[model samples]
Target: MIIAIVGATGTGKSDLSVSLARRWGERGLRCEVVNADAMQLYRGMTIGTAKLSIAQRQGVPHHLVDVLDVVDEASVARFQADARAAIDGIIERGAVPMLVGGSGLYLAAVLTDFRFPGTDPELRAHWEAELQRLGPADLHAVLADRDPAAAAAIGPHNGRRIVRALEVGDLTGEPFSAGLAARETPWRPYRQFSLELDRPRLVARLDERVRGMWRDGLLDEVRALLPLGLERGVTASRAIGYAQAIAQLRGELDESEAIAQTQALTRRYARRQVSWFRRDPSIEAMDAAADDLAAQVDRRVAAELVDTMGG
Candidate 1:
């Protein structure tokens, strides 16, 4: 059986995945992790992305981690094919594939048979050039006027996707949302779980998490990645803490200001993640901060996997 662990950031989703994997391993069940987190795909992104080291992983095999350089674009289409292939191989080997991360769209792309509209190179380049000249907010305004719903769905911060939306708009002369509202059955069936925490408590934890990343040498990690062309990478450059930390390094923000901005921005992003995952009725919610959270998740996943295997 395949399992997906999802939820908002700072909700202990990663820890719970390790807990369940350890528990299942002790029970003689073989399982491995396939990451759905977009940022963790880059190498040398450990401290900021909270990527586990080999020692921390405790022999649990992980796929799709560190598979991309900072220079590579993270394409959901590519991930969908790669992850599904991994899941299929794991199932064939009689081992379960545990997909984990808070990247809702990437998770959906892997779990569901979502398709993207066609792209034109020249049209895309035109929009991207406009993005460079006018910036994401201005380009986003153009999309808002052309297709407000699409603009709303694709946030202004996501310049790559904003470019795609405009390209689709130019090509189709239709609202990009029309393509999104269409859906189909998932690539494979699995039990999906999401973690939840109280807003106040989550905020506190998020603040600590941001501080922890910095304490763990996020500045050093970013400094190392800079030589690897991190700033030139469109997607990698804007990652939550990475962007602010880069600003700090560039003398745009002091260390304290960068940390504060990262914390606040992360909280807002987490809210968006919750909104994205909650819209899917298939995901079962679980208490992330509960003392018995690990056991509770184990029990549910245990029962579901048994029934699935038997059937």
Candidate 2:
């Protein structure tokens, strides 16, 4: 079965994935990870993203990580296709596929009956140009009029998403949120878990993690990626710590300001993730701070597998 380990950032999702894979291996059931984190899909975005190195992964095979260039736009539709293919391939090899990440939307794309509408390049370009001309707030006002639900959900600050919402609405002549509607039925046989942590504790952990990213030389990583078109990258350049690092590199923000801003944004993003996943009733919640999280999740998976077999 497809197993999803999801939560907000700094919730130890990656560590749990590796731990489960190792434990499953000990029991002679092969398990591999398929990354559902959007930023982790890009190569060379390691330190800021908290991506585990090859050594840290402890030889557990991972797919869909480091498969994209920084310059490439990260499309949810494209990722949905790639991630499903990877999961099917792993299942074909008689291994369990673990979908691991805090990216709630990405996880939903795989785990739910999510569908994507066809895109019209001309409509997309029109919305993108409108976003560039009018800015996110003004463009979002336009979306609010066209599809109030989408506008409320997307908010005024996210220009890229605003553009997509408008594009989808104009293209399909329906509310953008309608395109995101998913049935309760999953696309695959899956067991899902969402790690839960109290906001104060999670905020503290996320702030420290942001500081750790800077301590680990996020600026240096951004510098290394700049030559590889990181600055020109539509998606990569806007990543939380990476964006702050770029601002620091350009002398627009001091080191302290950059780090502080990144910490704040990371916490905000984490809240959004929690809200997104909280809407899904199928994901079982597990305390992220629990000492026996991995073992607990493993037992749940084992029970599910047995139940599947008995049926």
Show where candidate 1 strays beyond 4 Å: 145-149, 172-174, 182-184
lDDT of 2 by residue, 40-142 (tens): 9999999999999999999999999999999999988899999999999998887889999987668878887888888899998998899889998899999
In model 2, how large is the Cα lDDT of residue 134?
Answer: 94
Each model's backbone clash number:
0, 0
Pairs of colliding residues, candidate 1? none
Error of 1 at 205 (Å): 1.1
- Which candidate leads in lDDT? 2
Q: Write the per-residue lDDT of candidate 1 for residues 1-311, one digit (tens) a residue.
A: 67999998878777777878888888877788999999999998888888888988888889999999998899878888889898888888777789999988788878876777678999999999999999999999999999987787677778898888889888988887665554346668777899988889889999999999999999999999999999998789889999999999999999999999999989988888887777778899987877867688788778777666553
Off by over 4 Å in 2: 152-155, 306-311
Pairs with steric clashes in candidate 2: none
Superposition error at 89 for model 1 (Å)? 1.4
